[model samples]
Target: MADRVVAHQGAACWATLFTHAHYLPCLAVLLQSMRACQTRYPLVVMVTETVDARTRERLARMGCVLRDVDAWRVPHADGSLAFERFQNVWTKLRAFELYEYERVVMIDSDMLMCHNMDELFDLPLERGMIAAAFACTCNPKQIPTYPAEWTPRNCGYALRPHPPNDARQLTKPTYRLINSGVVVLEPSQEQQAEIHTFILRHTERVAQYRFPDQDLLADVYRDRIQMLPWYYNALKTLRQCHPDLWNDGEARIIHYILDKPWLLGPSPCGEHTHLHSLWWDAYASLAAHPATLSMTRDEWANEIALHVRGI
Candidate 1:
């Protein structure tokens, strides 16, 4: 793994977004997990201007290369008040604007890395093509808010690899939907502009983007994507909703799809109890680090009790 990572040295990096102050705690635990994995690649934390100077300083102290970016949200394009809440998520596409890094593995701040995933950097990522896991369109919540197409049968994972070989990488699925939770991106200014125009110009089309970045990205790059195995972006919901395709032991990273573990704390949890504890363990490890400067012990306890746990 170390030798493979060296091949992409100075050309690849890990990137994640932090929109505001509230998401800082989530980013802290994620960074802690990276430290545990001994990730050799630099992590570029893209932060919006909404984050204050204090939060920026804390991120710097955590050994992040901070890239200040403007907030990207176009609610008028969606034209629905109900979908307005997800408009902020469009900001995540800013990772594409980072043309400096040849290959950028962008992930959400809410996720936790279970082990060393530096191997993803070594994977082939051609121009105009991305590598990402297929979305488990199980529609577990059965919510009307989701698109009508989101069903188990329509999910990309439903397509079988004969003999159940998880090593097989499927590129073309009828659904062609890629989960943007964890994506291997080839940064390009031209690609960025094209996606931006596609979303803004196609107003009626963007209306169907119920999942914001996920919908828009999958649509724009559907034909030009390489679908990875489910383990890379293992959604927490799959444990029960799509258990046939899930194996927590094989999952390289856990995507906290519905509920974040940090917010759940040590309550009488049912759904993702062990997974929540996994995230808490990373937080605890971060708390004890000698170089830890972002959140003090008292501050962490207060945040969890008041803001997160709501005691």
Candidate 2:
């Protein structure tokens, strides 16, 4: 057994990645939430060259440690680049490269932390036990393939044949698919190298998955992952699908899945609408700060109008 002392010795940090300028407001809101909750760990943001100097400056002003990383390009079966499918998500893989920290909790900029979830860092980290919450199951009505009958208990794992040839069969049932919006991982140079190699080795196969990073990470960690309670990644969809578990006061995190609150018009009634109001409250808190007052009124108005007018 690896010595617990050595395995858990280094500092833990909070990290997030965004490749575009449009996400800056959301990132600011997320960072504000972290500060509001008084997170104990350092915060880091990974950006590609696409993020402009102004945005970088703002992020720096927010006390975020900014790191530049390259976006990953998808490759063809013949070892050539596939331009159409080029993804910025590959930047998230760099979380494993954060060797300075023993463990990194990667949160997506689209999420809001309702409470201080520093307790997640205390969970066991042996054998790369990535801690994450199950992604909210899709509405079968919206997605025909995913049956409405499917519940968390029955839908955690499905037996799908391995790609490139369905000859070998593997039957290991693990927790349902995890949402990559928030992830807890212990950085390891060896694991980082292994993940890189795995991506390169299965480049063609990777193209087939809906979400490359989430699918790849889930496939790699499967049974090894530690399942956090649903409150950790309480998706907006849960309010409609599983109201029994959707308690705003108790949820540690609220993930703005599919339709982001910042991009939606006000609805007459719905749980998601309530959550959207909360998101605006968080945004307001950040925008009202004297340091962040320079954030243009036009930017805020435009965001609201775009959503209100259904643009």
Candidate 3:
């Protein structure tokens, strides 16, 4: 058994998130990571969009609190992708200011903690937001890779242009482009009201946009949010950024969101088309974890297969 030490002593709490059944692997990896860290935070809450009977039983056995919400219930006008399903969950999380904890770190279910993050809460959100990385192209050469819709002006990347001569630009981007994977939020009625208005306005326009939630989050909060250290939502995107990440260092979370762990370990990019094994490894790990409740490999295969069929 791993040593169990509460990183926050007695006054800290954090949340690991998921939606529908796609969260199984993320939940398993998250719990195992927390266990490895020996974090003794009072509660480990799993936010989901209705868990199946099997998952509910499994989470209960692990002694994790499960909050089931209706994804469909989230206010949506057109329901493009309903990505804001998460924002609705955040509404529930933000309500916890009434709780005794001083900070709440919300993590996406598609991420894993590679190291202990006991010190993250210590960094106050006094006048800023906390996040892992920025969205879209960072390097000059990588600019063409993203579609125009994902560029700075289009509600995908930061709302500002990249600086030409600034070498530190990637390290400290000028605009607010928070990857929703890992965020450390301090509860404030002011912040929550802003967030609520942002969500409400986007909810009304989902019928017109393709990527409504991602669009709103990037566009609305572009100037207001703050960028945290990169390692927080360390994306497994490409090689250029990988070498800097130290397994024993400050990086707290690994967000394998796009090239999701369900399909691949790290996203296969460029000439790596032959590396389907990366995807296989991710699927295998999820299948092998003993703590995983419900939704077996066959079921996941079928689920993804359905996605491919439509594609």
lDDT (10s digit) by residue, model 3, range 1-311: 32323223336667654444555545655666666667655335544545577656656666576555434334444434424444444334443342445566666666666667766666544343433346534432444323343432332233223212232443332343446666666545666567566666666554443334344455655544556556666655522333333242555665654445344434444533322334344444655654343445575455433332121
Lowest lDDT block of 10, candidate 1: 1-10
Off by over 4 Å in 1: 1-9, 76-84, 162-174, 288-290, 293-307
Candidate 2: misplaced stretches above 4 Å?
1-9, 76-86, 144-154, 157-174, 265-271, 290-311
- How well is each residue in 1-311 modelled by candidate 2, as lDDT tens digits? 64332333568888888787677667777877887899988788988888889778767766889988877665433322222233566678789888888888888888898999987777676665687776555453364434344454443322221110221232223234677888888888888877777777876677565556776788777655666677788777877776655677988988987667666643424556788888877776665663553445565455322333232
What's the alpha carbon RMSD for model 2? 6.4
For model 2, give the 10-residue run with minimal summed lDDT.
158-167
Clash number by candidate, in order: 0, 1, 2
Evaluate all candidate structures by whole-model CA lDDT and list the values in order: 0.74, 0.68, 0.49
Highest-scoring model, TM-score: 1
lDDT, ranked from best to worst: 1, 2, 3
User: Which of the numbered candidates is closest to the native, going by highest lDDT?
Assistant: 1
